[model samples]
Target: MRGRGHRAGRAARKRRQKQESVVQSVSLCHELQYVRLMKFLHQRGFTSTLLQPALFTDTGRGLQAVKSIKPGQLLISLPESCLLTTSTVLDSYLGHYIKSWKPRPSPLLALCVFLVCERHLGEASDWFPYIDVLPAAYTCPAYFTDDVVAVLPSGARRRASEQREAVRELHSLNQNFFRSLQPLLSQPVDEVLTCEALRWAWCSVNTRSVFMSHPSNDSLSGQDVYALAPFLDLLNHRPDVQVKASFNDVTRCYEIRSVSGTLRYQQAFINYGSHDTQRLMLEYGFVAPCNPNSVVYVDADLLCDVLRGDRSLDQKIKFLKENNFLHNLTVSSEGAGWRLMTALRLLSLPQTLYHLWKAVLLGQVLCEEREEWSVQTAKTLCQRLLQDSHTALDKITNLLRQCDQPVREQLDVVESLRQEERCILGSCLELLEGPPRQPDELLSCAPDVDAVS
Candidate 1:
């Protein structure tokens, strides 16, 4: 009996060792400090780690330049070993479950799963140093409260709903895939991979990941083109700065060339590309002042209502949609956008002049009467938008003055978005009501679409 007990003890030790190995292989994240992160990167082949985390009043946390850097300087050449990408996921213990599951998970889902799982692993996670610095919460619509979401403009309302629904649906759809990872995880997959957990992971990937092309794979539901880089993701976005960022094939490092170099002690910023104010607010959770790409998206129902009096509206709307000209209607800093003008001209056509729709679309000048109708219709739309903008702005002001609530920050973001949108509408009206001059290609031979202010 004593010999039998000894044998059992030996067996127990073997199982414990196996569990430790499995845990170590897939450990996630713990609270890693800046010093440790810098140290971690230095050891992993990063030579020029000459930056530190800094705080800015305007942009919150961003990387600060410790030394003066010149134009065309290679600001950051991050090694690929630091990237946590889908390839890393596919090679882990969870990879086999991902492969043999009845339905394949999206490449995005795979990345989110890895991040959440690793984060749950705490100190055991190999990338704990990097994950420790990631924001505990995000400001994207997915993180917005019900009260905050209730106040979004007509244009952004649909998109915000879809963003939240996407997270929820993704969580609901992938229950089996989550369950398949039970053998590798310390707890039940549901506990670690909750909907809230997935949401946090999804936002991290959406807001922080970099663009890195991946090898073609039929297994992923969509393209797997994102990679999470550690120090590289620290750079905040600045619209005016010019930079060249890419992965260097020979060096196997993700490099950034700062065309507009960051000065010493200044916060460094990167360009997220021609994103408008609303886009910045919805996807990344912020807004920019005087964004050139910013525009007010016209509501389709409002567009239809404005043209309802015309008898041929039904046929005109059909032609516009069929030709793919109905979507993307907008008003911008330059006044009525091309797409909006194009659709309006078609909608303004008299029933007898239906054949001239193509001519109108192609920038041909219709009769003075038809041109006047289109101009009047545009003016009406802009007027309605201006009223809506004013109402929202005033409501926001009153809410802020009336209370100092926690939703103040959310209200402020929406305020900036609204203000920029109002600017675009105001310009549209000036263009519509401006002096009669040479008609531009956008309109059916009417006044030039120029913003006076």
Candidate 2:
């Protein structure tokens, strides 16, 4: 009995030891991947010692400052040889075969095909190190399942639907193109150009590419509109930080300089222009909390609904469409933009005064007492927005409450977006409901009619 008990304890110890070895092997493999990627970048002229990758609980993988980086200092400089541009695809090993194919692929499409080809080549591909690190999936709303997309706010849902359609079209195109190339290549077309693979490549280009004009002497005309920069693409986005990125011809390098200094161990960020949350989420698959550029889109259909009872509604809609003032009605932190206000004013106008309102918008005339009507129209619009926003918020809140466990992160994103909309709507309501001012006082506070037009 004593010997049997000792044998059981020995078996447990061996199992524990084996498990530890497996864990260490996996950790070592990840470290090796990191090292290989870094080594590849170094060989390609990324010699900056100040920046290194670090994992963060909130942001996943991002570049961290290994030492204090000063303002105006060059952080990264990749020579033209390293950029993955249209020219690179055209000059690649696969390009020779694709040249004879009828109906030439656009630069963007060519890049997607190039990525697919390289991926199939596996370890033999020159870009294997870079391709290995590409994200396996994206969180962009366009990739969401239909059921998940249906619950989004109306404007977001519409945008997501549009994006999904675009992807579907691209997949069809890729399928046909790949079929034609199958006989010319060793690998099967279906293996290289699956819908999922095409989407991964397309999004990799969409999310990480930068725009730059090609060298003047190159055969490509105009500009190389999109080029994928390997290491440079790892820098995450922040709306507040300003970065100066440009290709320096003299230096023959794509250089990035920081306008805002970063302290040691701090994450460095770049501004991808002043994009609203919806645009960011659609393209980048991430949202910045408290983004200054966030805006809530108020659909033009809502305004049409508001003016449904107005007898002149059809005429107003006609006038708006003719004058090209019919779209992009939105509300932001600063309140509604002039386009929304103008649409509302046009809807509120009587049929007899449609031509006169057109003249006003064209800056042909100014009415002295127009403030009262404008103010009233703005208040009505604000009230309608508030009601709609509250209803959407309540629906989202109820959905969240019904979940028995923690909701998915995507749902959390939807809730955050709706909350922002509600907050902005409340602000608009507060401003519209403030004590009424005399017509002349309100007109004095308003922007110049010509400038607004």
Candidate 3:
């Protein structure tokens, strides 16, 4: 028994060592690739030394400040030759053949084709250095396996489905367009535009491409509005940071300046707009733990579900549709908006008072009596939403507990989303369940309401 135990321990140690070696090899390869990419950019006029690659224990690869960067300092300036724009793709060797197709492809589709063709050329392609460093697979929910996708919350699942459909449509277009060129081409269509190849290229473009507005005098107006700005695209997103990026016609380079200062060794980030956690996850394949714009969408269907037993449901639905209040219901850090509360109040009104409610909704009159019912109805709806959110969160939490070690990281992202949602719903519930005040008290306190009335 002692001999067997000793053998087993030795085997385990060997396996761990092998795994560590593999990980180290991959890290080393990535470091080399980063160096090559940086060198490539430097040769093309990226001279700023403020940014350097910094690996985090948890966040993987991100750009860090080598020296303290002051606000308004230009951190990167890549010449037009470095930008992988639609024009560049359209002007490439592959683009020469793509233009012969019956109908010209959109800039995005053309870029995807260019990516696949360039990849097929392997080392011979001019863009090989840039292409080699692009991520092999994306983390976006759109790339999640079927089982993982099935577990996504309804909102995320819907968005993922939409993205998948878009990819499918683009793939179909590629197929049809490539089939037409197969007769003239020496290579098989599959080898040139395989689904897997197209998908990789599609995701690379989706996640890495930056929007660049063309100059008014540029002839490429209304073409592809996005470009792949190599090193600049490597900057991770933080909601708080602001960056001023633009194409400098005078210098003939793309410039990115930090509007906010960065401390030495701290990761510098760019604002990807005011995206919520869900939007970030769907589009960028990662969620920001501290996204200030994080919100929980309370769709009209959920609202309708909450008011399922209300009388004259059809009438309420019609009114909601007519008033265009059946959508855009959301809860954020500020809690539920007034529109949601007003919509719930409208639903709670009796059939006889529908006209009065409509009048109030249209700002024709002030119905003080229904104000209490509105507040009560809003509270009830919030309570239901809060309960449902908690249930969803519990399911996700339980799944996390039982999930396999390999998939736990991905599940953690879903868990973060659910937790944010729960926080939003909880906040809304708190606001709705605040101490009930008399309508007169509310009116007296609101000088604006008194004046409006």
Ranking by lDDT: 1, 3, 2
Model 1 bad stretches (over 4 Å):
1-32, 395-407, 440-453
Per-residue lDDT for 1-453 in model 2, tens only?
A: 000001011111121111232211011114665677777877877776877766543444667787899998887787777788887887887576457555656666778888988888888888887787776556566556664576666787898888777777887865666887676456788877877787767777877787676644233333347778876776777789998988898998888899988988777777788888777767766565568888777676776776566665676788788877777777776776667766665554555455556545643322434444555656666677667667765765666566522234445555556666677767766766676444332212233322212
Per-residue lDDT, model 3, residue 134, is 74
TM-score leader: 1
In terms of lDDT, model 2 sits at 0.65
Q: What lDDT does each candidate get? A: 0.72, 0.65, 0.65
Candidate 1 lDDT by residue in tens digits, 224-290: 8888887677777767878898889999999988897877877777788888887887877677555
TM-score of each: 0.85, 0.81, 0.81
User: Which of the two, 1 or 3, has more lDDT?
Assistant: 1
Sequence-dependent TM-score of model 2: 0.81
Candidate 1, residue 291: how far the Cα is off, in Å: 1.4
